[model samples]
Target: MKFQDYKVTDINLADWGQKEINIAETEMPGLMALRKEYSSSQPLKGANIVGCLHMTIQTAVLIETLIALGASVRWSSCNIFSTQDHAAAAIASKNIPVFAWKGETEEEYNWCIEKTLSGSDTWAPNLMIDDGGDLTKIVHEKYPGLL
Candidate 1:
């Protein structure tokens, strides 16, 4: 999608992560089925989504599914240690604005979460998906107007 900004542990790991994402995709029936049914319809067209969850192979697959459904997204990890650099690489490789890595400090974790809320002037994220409450809390606390 050629996003203008993103942060990840390493772009070089994208190839390895893409392989993992490919494997995961094959195993996810529901998402694949949904993709097949909805890609052309693009029910999510013009939706802007921001997400905070564990960055993993599963998440990578889900991210792609969301894209296939036509939502533009920005994403981050909810927990510092829960991030998978390779998965982040895979997501970022698509030029999706993903901000995350493994083992972030408190500052970096917050920074990553904050980043997902940006591009508001351009993207205007209308949907938010978060594993823990952090992402949702941040939005309410710092970006109340978004609601």
Candidate 2:
């Protein structure tokens, strides 16, 4: 999906979430080291990744690391209630596509998952990072051709 098509609860909270992400970056030494080590080599270069996880400050750090490693990414929350709006906003502010919000209904949750899976042929995700099996299950059920 295009970045403009991303569905987030609020874009206004980006600045606040960005501050939290900055703090989280400082606490995540291992991921930071990976960014430093692989940024030049770009091991994940040309990879497209879809991530389904809790959209929290910590997850933001992980997402940023993936970008640093040269992967393009789209993200959605694994749990409807686990999303942190500010964190989603922060990630989205960087032009990364994010499809999630706190307190989503079952329909909205599924919709977010679909958004993560939707993209142009050139932008389609080749890698998946799922904390829960929901995203995988959906892919298996609805887009078996991909599997």
* TM-scores for the candidates: 0.95, 0.95
Global Cα lDDT for candidate 2: 0.91
How well is each residue in 1-147 modelled by candidate 1, as lDDT tens digits? Answer: 456588998888999999999999899999999999999999999989999999998999999999999999999998899888999998998988999999999999999999999865767899999999998999889999988
| Candidate 2 local lDDT, 1-147, one digit each (tens) | 555857889999999999998998899999999999999999999889989999999999999999999999999999999999999998898898899999999999999999999877667778899998999999999988766
Score candidate 1 by TM-score against the native. Answer: 0.95
Model 1 residue runs over 4 Å out of place are: 1-4
Which stretches of candidate 2 lie above 4 Å from their native place? 1-3
Model 2: residue 94 alpha-carbon error in angstroms: 0.8
